[model samples]
Target: MARGMGRWRVLANVAFAAGVLALAGFGVFQVANRRWQVQPTFHVRAQFPNVVGVEPGHRVRFQGIDAGVVAKVVPPGRPGDPVELVLRIDESLRRLVREDATARIVVEGMIGARVVDLKPGEPDAPAVADGALIRSEPAADLADLMRRAGESLREFDATATEARAGLEHLAALAADVRDGKGSLGKLIRDDDVYDNLVALTRRGEKAVEKLDDDLMAVKQTWPISRYFESRAYYERDKVLYRPGSHRESRTLTAEELFEPGRAILTPVGRTRLDEVGRWSKASGRSRSEIVIAAFTEPGPEPELDEALTQEQADAVRKYLIDRHGVDSAGWFRKRKIAAVGFGAEPPRFEDETAQAPSRRVDIILFTPQA
Candidate 1:
């Protein structure tokens, strides 16, 4: 009996030693992993619209490096306000985080814990002060993505069903046409109807040709010829024709319209543009186009000159619309206003042979003769 009691005592001693060693190992592991927060850290506040899986103790990473952990997740005070997170980041990151640094919540891996990913800003940007609020980019939710994918699949199924129905209906209509059951099918089968249609079409073509010849003869007559020439009415082909220009234009110097080498308009520039707006209104051609064209002298930097001309033209267009209520779109959505920039290379017009000004803006009221 005494021997058995001694054996039980030995077993208890072994069990106790094993428990002590396990506890010591656990403590060492925790210390090695820095899980007990032995290092100094600072707080940074960030706001996010949705914090679905984020919570306190979530890891924070700076450019993929583990920096710290989330200390708190504060709920929004108002309904529309974002959820704010307080991050306990290591003090070493204070120099890296900038005023423009952005934060985003991302998953570590498949089925892993959610973490805060911090992206540093430009080197020239000001550093973020400790305890400052940083902006967060919106995080995409897995549940939301899955829901959208499901909705798309349903839409695709619905569209396929509709397409199938339309094709079946079309096939039935084709069968009916082939069986000579409808008016179209009857017309296709009747020889007398086809013959009559051909004869009528030939007569119509002859009548049109004769009318065209008479019109041409009248246009060549003495008085009519003079009238046509004055009007610049000429036919080039059966489908194309040319008409004379009823175009009037006003030219303004760059010195009069803008500050030197800049697109900014001056007081004098505004006055000149105002006059242009008034002139367009008084032109009495509501259907005419209001074209604003800007030109610049050839410079060492052609790109800059082109950009300047474009900006100048756009500035004038904006002023006319804002100050004069110019109708940009006319009846039937026809564009009545246009702005173009010709940088040191002006396109040739029929009656325009004189050299273009070194730098100029032209406001033209153009109407083609009807």
Candidate 2:
């Protein structure tokens, strides 16, 4: 019976050992399978000039979302060759990875770990094929940046030292000037120089007064007097009438007003004319004139273009008069309506293009100075 007990004990020990081994194996399987829960991954390759802090198993992010991981990293064969990385991205986000997508190494936080960032391409771009190579921008090296900052600080220190020396020399020169040791000091301190300057200024004032009297005499004399009067009249006219000239200039493209190569007003043209008529009535300017000017682009036959532009301007004027009752019998009895057309003449403004603005119409309100 004791021999039997010994054999049972041995069997019990083997059973316990087997159970422990099974449990350990299951735990490992669970851990391994957890990594691959987001299944059906697609692989892509990227070549970076520097992957200083990047390593395998580093996270891959697409537009800030965690998408995949770095699968492998291959060091460059030569000094100038780029380091190659194999990335396994989730198949579900395959659409986001396009042919034009760019990959770059980026840091997670301030002086933190590094990861691979993938920028998705335009929405209209085609999806990137599996296992295709994608472009990479190199990661910035922290150590290199720190080194450059140190060098800049050293340079600034040297510049500051030089500036200090220059300021010291300037201060010494200023001290010498204040002590009357230079020509500039003598000019500043001498009473004789001050008296001479005052006398010269008085003589200059007398000479200016005499010149002004001579000009006035010339302006009052015969033929020259007429010239001065004409100049004064012109200046007065400019001052009085400049603000009233082209007080309101509304430019309308030919396409907006009329059919192509036709003088008839379109529906849109009639709508715009209605707005202008309402504005004119609201303005209450009974003495103002309406001037309609039309322009055409240069054509093979200049005469035809001129005639077409004239017809267009006349059509607009007729529309405003007949449809809107802008006539010569009402409050606008004395107001004149004029239509002018320019064929192939460049606009006064150089910024005007040959496209729409050249083929245009301008409606201007001309108010004479009261």
Candidate 3:
């Protein structure tokens, strides 16, 4: 009985060991193949309103190489909110985390793996912190894409309308060109108008040539015949020209008007300047006298103060000649003794420089002895 018990016990121990070995093998294999073999990585979140081809166990990659896996999909906030995707990235790539780096769900392979490809930020930037969230810029949603498409259609419609208007205007312009309406039309379609203009220009040139010839002929005959006749007629009878020419000449002086010291005016010698001024003005120009021709013995006329004796007249002339110069030669006019005028003053003209109670002047008229 003891021997039999020992055999059984040995067999039992071997069986138990085998069972333990199997369990240990299973536990080690579980840790290696599915648990410990997978790297522990931090969760990064991405929000999506729509994730068409993404699911848990979907491959995550940087470029094309596998780097991580999609771990969970949860609401961005509440249960009904837009979903946020979480990823588990291999720890070996932890150094690659950076703030500007992004994770995108990308189409991969021929079958197209739904992937989270991490784009590394510039190396100069700071690394991403633990449990950090990554922002997702997703493909356009259906409504937004449709709205953009509608906007594009409206823009295309507006462009087409403008193009149609331009084409219509061009067609009208082309018609105008055919019909010879505008300046451009005239340029394109109306050679007759241009020809008429050219012909008119030629005619004008010929007319100008004829006019020049006529002018030359007129010029050739002008100086000797026509001009001389015109000049004689203008100079002779035109009294207005005489005074104009006299005025244009330099003023004549008193000496220049007479030869040597002899005066040109009789008034300066026989009478005062005032006496000559009275001839036309103060006293009348017409003179009358009652001459007594002796019909009987020479008798004194009533108007004469008794004809003075020659000696008496000589005596009177001598006294007068001493003070007021006498006309002893008697080369002056005899005058009626109505009124006598003496020295005169200058005539008044408009004064450019005026004064109060302005300066005075005297005027006089007189008769001269004959």
Candidate 4:
């Protein structure tokens, strides 16, 4: 009888040991799966325009902390409705999730798993009820980003290739000029050509001056003077070359306008702008359009340079409008005032070259022809 009792006891011990091992394994599984919660959880709903790989069992976070899991992903019943996501959040976070809270599907780490990131609302806002909808922001489309990046890379590669070819051509031309082989080489090397060019330039200037004088005399004489006065005609020394209208421009160099490498106006810059303001006030008409354009030297980053030029242009525009009382708008007509920046890409003008003149601002006035 004692031997029988011993056998029964051994069987019972084995069963007890097996049960203990099973319980321990269950606990480990629950902890590892993030389901070992002591408190209850509540449901919340969010709608997204694009889920982008989100599915059930995906983690949800509240301000970057692991707070829940997505319970369901319900597709729209009809068309145009957003995809709905049901989140099971810890009840402890109920007060923190207010009515104004926002949700968005974001990649957790650098190209890591995707999760629902929650941004809690204001503290004074009402707490969100269970099963309440939370506003969702559209997911950041990784595919679109990748596609744009690829296009930019291709464009950069093409630009680099063109630049290399241009450099090679320029190097060959320079060598030819040095060897005095081409027409340009001869023009640069010959003393007689240089002297003739200088003399021709002087003669051209004199002719222009004489023409101006003769035109002024004619305007001041007889019925022409009366006609010009009615039309508000003024003598323009330098005019912008455009077909449709009369446009005049005052060019200001960056060296005299802004602090070195910065957008801030210097004392000299202010003085120069003050002179321009006075000119506009004295001669400008309300019906005319004023354009303030700024340019910068080409650099490695075109975007930064463009931004700087824009700021400079805006500064000039602001000063002219605010301080000088330049007419930016008319009573019955739309304002034609505009500010633009062309970084490293100056528009074609007379005697344009790759020189310091490229880095400058032009205040242009466009007036209707009488």
Candidate 5:
């Protein structure tokens, strides 16, 4: 009976072992096939300027999310070249990349883990195929990074040195100002300029006050002001209490009374049409245009030849033949004559007036170099 129990126990143990083995196999298969196993994996390469801190098994990310891992990092198919990073991209995030996706090495935070980050070019890009490698942007190394920081520190030291020099210079300037050395020093230490400025301000204030009083006195003298002064109204151009030269009539428009020579009917003078007829023809412009042109002028340039004389003016033919340059290109020279017309002066008001003297000059052809 004991032997039979022993045989039965052996068979039970064998069956239990087989069942455990089957369950373990099923569990492994479930883990492998689940969680996006069909998703896909893509590979890429990266180059680090230096690889002292980089190693295999480093996580690859996009933005901040985990998307892949570094599989292998080796020299670029040869010796003494940028090392390549072979990435095994996750199936879910692999679709985010395109053929033009860029790979770059990044550190998470200050003194953080180093990883490769892929920027999947544009948003609606096509997914990259398998086994293809994207370009890896060269990354700065630890030494290079430290060197950048050291350069910044050195610059800061230089700036401090400059600032110290500026302060010393300013202090010396202050000492000079106290000693009354230069113009600025004189302004600080002397009292003559301050006295002059104060006196000028007082004069200006007195002049302004006098001008205000004069304006008020003149306002009381006009006919419009006379009505206000008397506080009474009178008939139009009649019922006059007084008549004098101060109240004499004058012309404000062209048809009104004018000087003897300025009347439109006068001969041997600039007729009214001469001022107004420019638009009628193309010779001269209206007085209004002449005034506007006077204001809209480029400032004067220095005289080209101070020593140009009657000899030069008469020798225009000779200079053009000798010194004057020939226009090979024959580009047309557009010349304009500009001058200031200070309105007619005393002579213009008389019936018999002399011609206005023209303050103008003629040009000579001068070249810059021989």
Candidate 6:
């Protein structure tokens, strides 16, 4: 009876060990097959130019959901041939992945594992068949990204070095200027230079004034005056039967007539007034009247505002009379010239803004009846 009991105990132990080994083998088979935990899947192939960080057993995801696993990674046999990846995707989700579905390797997390990501194709498109090749986008590796970043940093360093060199050059130039080492430095440091410039400007002005007076005097001399008189008579006869009174007007912006916030005329203003001079010479009217009307927008100071407008009008009239030889004597005895200032007056246009066109000067010329 003891011998029979020992044999039965040994058999029982052997059966238990066999059962454990079978269970372990089944677990291994399930893990290797992968279909034991989910529905059956279909195999699909994808070719990629590069498959960095991708290998067999990597999880495959469809729209971020766990869908399959990479079964195999086949390296290219030829230099130009692409690396092939075999994927096992769930059959149920197969319809969502069409022939145009793209497969790309992606990083899972910050410096974590990588996975295969499947992007679904158009809904109306036909589904990809089993063993069909899906398109793949090559994954950019961390090493490549680091290399590019290094290149960019090198370029930025070069630029920074150049900027530093430029700043050094500028500092040296500024030091030279401060030490009165250059012509500009001398101009800044020397008061005599400023005084000389002022004296020269005054002399130039006097010379120009004298030249203008001499020219006017020559125009009014015997022979020249007779020629002008004859031209005037001829013009008058030609216009005898036409409308007797002639009027001309010009509108100028405040900026075109005077400096900002000052009645003094800028060089630009003088140049523009030269056009009026030319027009006055061409008019050839002996008995004419010029009305210089200056207007300004409302300002904080009423008296100063009016004074500015008056000064602007006066400046225009004086420029015409003094520089353009619009004399009020001899042939111009009947000529009437006036300057009028309309201070802080609203513009005639209903939609006029506060600035610009509202601040203007109007010059009007009227020729009397023949």
Evaluated with lDDT, which candidate comes out highest? Answer: 4
Candidate 2, 1-370: lDDT as tens digits? 9999999999999999999999999887775544443478998999988888788888899988878888899899999998999998989899889988999988787556899999988889999999999877878875565446434433443454455565556556555555667887665666565555446555655655565455456545643344333222212112223354446656788998999998999999889888877766565366776766788889999767867887798788778777876545365264556665556764344232345577988776666676
lDDT of 3 by residue, 1-370 (tens): 9999999999999999999999999888875434224456666677777777788777777656667777787745665567778777777777787777776666565454567778877898787776787767674343454445434433443454455565556556666666778988777756665555446555655655565454435433523223322211211112112221211111112222222322232323224323323332333222421100110112344212112222122222232234343222235753221111001111132122123111111111122223
Query: Which candidate model has the greater lDDT, 3 or 4?
Result: 4
Candidates in order, TM-scores: namely: 0.41, 0.42, 0.34, 0.47, 0.40, 0.44
Q: After superposition, how far is residue 99 of candidate 1 from its true place, in Å?
A: 1.7
Instruction: Give residue 51's lDDT in candidate 5 (0 to 100).
Output: 57
Which should have the higher lDDT, number 2 or number 4? 4
Per-residue error (Å), model 4, residue 285:
80
Which segments of model 4 are wrong by more than 4 Å?
1-25, 28-38, 190-370
Worst 10 residues of 6 by lDDT: 233-242
Name the lDDT value of residue 25 in candidate 1.
Answer: 91
Candidate 2 has an lDDT of 0.71
Which candidate would rank higher by lDDT, 4 or 6? 4
Output the better candidate (1/5) by TM-score.
1
Clashing pairs in 4: none
Model 3 poorest 10 in a row by lDDT: 288-297
* Model 5 lDDT tens row, 107-211: 767556788888888777677878777867777565565445434433443454455565556556656766778998777755665455446555655655565
Q: Which residue ranges in model 3 land beyond 4 Å of their true spot?
A: 1-42, 48-53, 79-82, 106-114, 125-130, 150-154, 161-165, 181-370
* lDDT by residue (tens digit), candidate 6, 1-370: 9999999999999999999999999888888666323458898899998887777888999998889898889999999899999998988898899999999988888555999999998898899999999888888676565445434433443454455565556556555655778887766766565455446555655655565455446445654444333223211112222245576767788987788988899899998889987786677377776666677878998656766886798798789878986645355274556666667764243122334466888776668786
Q: CA lDDT of each candidate?
A: 0.72, 0.71, 0.45, 0.74, 0.46, 0.71
Stretches of model 2 off by over 4 angstroms after superposition: 1-38, 77-80, 190-370
Best by TM-score: 4
Question: In model 6, where do residues sit more than 4 Å from their true spots?
Answer: 1-15, 33-39, 75-78, 110-112, 188-370
Task: Report the lDDT of model 1 for residue 152.
Answer: 47
Candidate 1 vs candidate 2, lDDT winner: 1
